[model samples]
Target: MKVVIYRVGQNQYATPVESIQSIERMLPIRPVPGAAAHVLGVANLRGSVIAVSDLRKVLNVEEQAFTPESRLLISNGNGYVVDEALDIADCADDAWEHVGEQKVWQRGDQLIVWEDLQA
Candidate 1:
């Protein structure tokens, strides 16, 4: 399967490219009171409003200050905040050798979460 690899601090995570609507630059986010810690806020993408979640917080990775270079990954009206957007690459057959029923995939030692973000 093809996926876009992104970094959360020093760790890496991958999500299917088909599941992503678009990758955008860091924009102003309106704080949502009473929202989850990982739920950063809402932003106007194109013309639609969407909630942005911090992948570092939700995925339990070390939190790093989001810089101007940070990217917003939107899927199903919801956005995921990631440190850096890496390349889109195809996974080799051997890479999926140990994956089970979990929505995540194991590529060597890295834990690749392959969720259908739209759902």
Candidate 2:
């Protein structure tokens, strides 16, 4: 299956590229009070307010300063976040075999968290 690979913490994870809406750079985020620490804040994405989450913080990884490579990967019905959006790659279903036994999280029975890219 084709997937959009990305980096988070110290590992790589794959999400089907078809679900991605867009990849954007860091924009001004309005801090939300009384929200989860992982919630970076919200930003206006082309007139639509989007919630931005810190992948590192969310995964309990060490915090790192945002660099030019840092990006927001909006997916899963336009409501998702990833660390650095890596290039899209085509991988066969067999290729995913290596991902076995990793922490996988299901999203609506459609997507699964392959692995922590930071690892």
Candidate 3:
């Protein structure tokens, strides 16, 4: 399957390209009261209001300040903030190794966490 590989802190992750609508630059987000802790809030992108979530918090990683490399992976009308958009590659299904609950892929020294954005 083809996947969009992204970074969160020093770790890398992958989500299927088919599940992503677009990869966009970080947009201005308005915080919503009483929202989930992992949710950054909503952003207005091209006249569409979409809720943004912190992939760092979702992955239980340390949150870092948004940098120029920060990107939003838009999926199902929602956005997930990631450290950077690294690459898009075709990965064989047999390449994935299940570690407990996570599906991980090894690329030399780097390990990419495979995720289903639709989940």
| Residue pairs in candidate 2 whose N, alpha carbon or C atoms collide under 3 angstroms | 9-118, 10-117, 10-118, 10-119, 11-117, 11-118, 11-119, 12-117
Ranking by TM-score: 3, 1, 2
lDDT per residue, candidate 3, 3-44, as tens digits?
999999888999999999999999999999999999999999
Best by TM-score: 3
How many times do residue backbones clash in model 2? 8
Give stretches of model 2 more than 4 Å off.
77-83, 98-119
Model 3 misplaced regions, further than 4 Å:
none
Give candidate 1's TM-score.
0.81
Clashes of 3: 0
Task: Tell me the lDDT of candidate 1.
Answer: 0.79
Question: Which candidate number has the best lDDT?
Answer: 3
For every candidate, C-alpha RMSD to the true structure in Å: 2.9, 6.8, 0.8
